[model samples]
Target: MYIVRFLRCLVLLLVGLATVTHARAADEDLERVAITRALTDYIDGSAHARPEQLRRAFHPDARLLLSRPGTAYWPVSVDEYVGWFSGAKAGQPTGRIGNVLSIDVEADTATVKAEILVPSQGARFIDLFLLRKLDAQWKIVAKTATREPSRRSADRVLFVLSSAKFHGASRLPAGVSFGEVVEAWDAFRAAGLTVDFVSPEGNAAPINVTEAGEFRSRFYDADLMYALEHTHAPSQIDPARYRAVYFVGGSNAIYGVPENSRLQDIARHVYERNGGVVSAVCHGTAGLVNLKLSDGSYLIGGKRVSGYPEEFERQDAAYFKEFPFLIRKTVESRGGTFLTSARDQGYVVVDGRLVTGQNYLSAKQVAQAVVAILRKPADQQPKQAAEKG
Candidate 1:
């Protein structure tokens, strides 16, 4: 009788152990599914602040990997990543990003692998995301990437667009003036910098809303308007977080950007403390004339800069009536040396804290100049090269 009872007790203990083991396996499987779902939602549903989905699946450090395929990688920050989420929610998706081929998750981290084939150029690209979990939550924390087409430089830049309206002319598509600013932006995006847009105020700084009916009647880029209307906020822009600030010009810039003291402060911080390029053109140049530097002197005081020339302003005789004076004269009087084109090319200048360009014609050259300066290694560009080359 004693032996039989002991055997029964042993059988029960074994059964209990098996049950616990099976349950553990099930939990891990569920966690994996949760991870995949969250990442998908982040990729898909993030537009509307799908907080519940984001909270459950991504750890606070969640990030996205965007880059050229097969190149050494760098990823954007969380806030920057989320800006896309908002934009995505507000607009139709442009496959600027390639397909997300896979998501690999481990005990505390994960990685996302993606491949891109762009329309502007048939460039092949690959990117990877590395994520980690804290407090039982998984989040994307890092990104590593590569691109098939080799670049002139290994570094990438993040260009900030402050425009709320697109630059499409009547005969052109919206944001047509994308020019070099947009082109560099596209290049950097293809190379995998999470370039994004945020307005001076949290709202979409109205486009040429009140301007020429023929010129201003249309909406901005549907894609960009989606991004702006969604993530448009001043708080998201922290100058300390970026390497440089690229301000593009729009006629609306005359009225939209000048009044923001905080935006001016961010511009100053990016220049003085972080040492990033602050490039502006046309009406976009107005922001600089008022930015006060650390030494209490205005930033353009002694810098050689350029923007819409006074003559060019006169050329647009009917359009520039609101501006009090010509950029060249105003800057020169303020102790800044102004630059201009030979009337054919876009004119630009780089002097210490300021980088300025002439009219719309000079936009591309100006962007290239800004990128060249920032790409240098720790201010070591053979002084002569920087000054004369």
Candidate 2:
């Protein structure tokens, strides 16, 4: 009677162990399927800009937390976050590509790490998702995000636009080149530099709307368009706030840029302190002609530079006759060793902190040069080629 009772008890214990093992395996399989579904929904919603997909993927109470450099936390609710895709055009690369890096599960809670790239806006984001099992379903409850720098992480650039709409002498409608500004703006943005627009007059700068080429037109999104219309004036800018300052070129630049005392002081402050790079392209070099350092020496004197060639001026006799001064001649007279390449081709010269581009075609190259200079340590920075006497 005792042996029979013991055997019965052992049989019951083995049955209970098997039941527990099966239940645990089933739970793990369910978790895997639910996690994958949530991730798929997120990718489709973001890449396609479909609010419905996003709505399904995220919990009603989910919040997106963004960490900005040296700034306070910015939180966005699900509805507010979906609003960003309201204007997205179908099939356009909105820079919303996402890749799952890893996913971890712990009982009722899970965490996922993902990378999102927004090429249009020149941004890459690292996102962390927190999820919980509610009503036997997994939904993203919160997300924390940080941006990964695409280039030199800490660089900030200032793009100086000409506020003059027409040259007083030439009577031509000239302000800033739409192509020049947008090209360099996009390049600098892609390289992860924070760019601010400023002008000599602190008013809306004119752009040659018709001058936007294929590249410029492709990138002229709402944000770029808005920034051009709301540029700040020189008086409104603080020199110390930027790591580089680029003078955008146009015929009107000849009217107010070189002679503006305030602009000169700002450039001097940036260059003298060795705090940043100073650059100009095309006719914008006119601005550099009279810039004197704090030591009372001309900024471009004995420095290598380039700008709009004399040939371009000669190409149009009527236009040339009405100009204030030839760009190349002014630069040379200022003791700058002017350099050039084939006309209309991009030619950029980097002389330490001073950079110059030959024409509108070179605008992008000049901006890139500024970024390169800012990336290096002060002690390891390349020295300017031997200056001319």
Candidate 3:
């Protein structure tokens, strides 16, 4: 009886040892994938100027600690830091350089070091990240960075504001949303990207007074408004001179932009011939509704796209009933698959050289997507457009 009992105890001890060994091996595998995912998220986010990607890479409480010339450590929450990229500067190239230099992992914590270079500004940055595993997901919990800034050549972006006024059916006074244009303009300027304004008729586009935010309201000065009104005509500019064409949105854009043949020509030449990006937000996508390549096929055919949804238009059905067509339905019918986020939240879709923002809220992200594409080497652009024809 004693021999039988001893044998049973030995068997139990062996099983317990094997279970612990297997658990440790499983944990090690999970940690490997988790570390790789976290690092990939950081690289792709930084390269593409995508805050949505950055948001996923970071923990909710992550903080960025920076050292500026005369300041002690300046700490910014991940939420606050991501806000910068969602602005006009959002698409501006960060000129990220280098791969993950190294990664060190111990238990549930890990660290990564990466480098970025802004050749245009002659700046270099080294970023260090501290991440933790929580609930089997790895997320960046802290970051520190050092930058050496220099000078470089600047690229230009054309801001194409809609020149129309009033919603189609009700003829209610409407123009470009104040927040859309001003916010995008501020972002572009901050990113050091040169900007110029254009319109269908080369005249100042009107403003939708009701759409202005506090920052835009305070910054709306006569000089700025006057400049917006005196925009350059499509015929007057060389597409080769610009890196991207951004279509700003307003209710009137749906009516005025789509029918402009010259604007279409400019967008085509820039995107097809010069390897530039074409972008639009909100009602501005109306401009793309009828855009075609040199081959006469629709530009957006087979593309993944997003814009203000058809549901939003129906919400104002009484007012929009007179429009020629809704933006979402039009794009979808033309072979573009439409994507939407929570109504009115910021969302931008990038498919090769084409970028579209869902609404006014998505304007900055659309611009950022454009900037990210432009920052890539010319050869890196998806040859989809070239092959589509």
Highest TM-score against the true fold, candidate? 2
Superposed Cα deviation of residue 290, candidate 2 (Å): 1.2
Which residue pairs in candidate 3 have backbone atoms (N, alpha carbon, C) closer than 3 angstroms, thus clashing? 88-187, 89-187, 91-368, 97-116, 120-152, 121-150, 204-229
lDDT for each residue of candidate 2 in 81-200, tens digit (9 for 90 to 100): 877765646334455666565566789999888767665666678888999888888899999988864433435688877788776655667767776787798789777776778887
Model 1, 130-186: lDDT tens per residue?
666666656656655566752323232334345434322222212213453444455
TM-scores for every candidate against the unseen true structure: 0.53, 0.61, 0.58
Question: Model 3 segments beyond 4 Å from truth?
Answer: 1-152, 221-223, 314-317, 382-389
Off by over 4 Å in 2: 1-152, 216-220, 314-317, 386-389
lDDT of 3 by residue, 193-252 (tens): 656777877755787777676755545464456557557777767788778888888777
The full ranking of all candidates by TM-score, starting with the best, is 2, 3, 1
Alpha-carbon local distance difference test for all models: 0.56, 0.77, 0.75
Better of 1 and 2 by lDDT: 2
| Candidate 2, residue 210: lDDT | 67
Residue 113 displacement in candidate 2 (angstroms): 26
Query: Candidate 3: deviation at residue 49, Å?
Result: 37
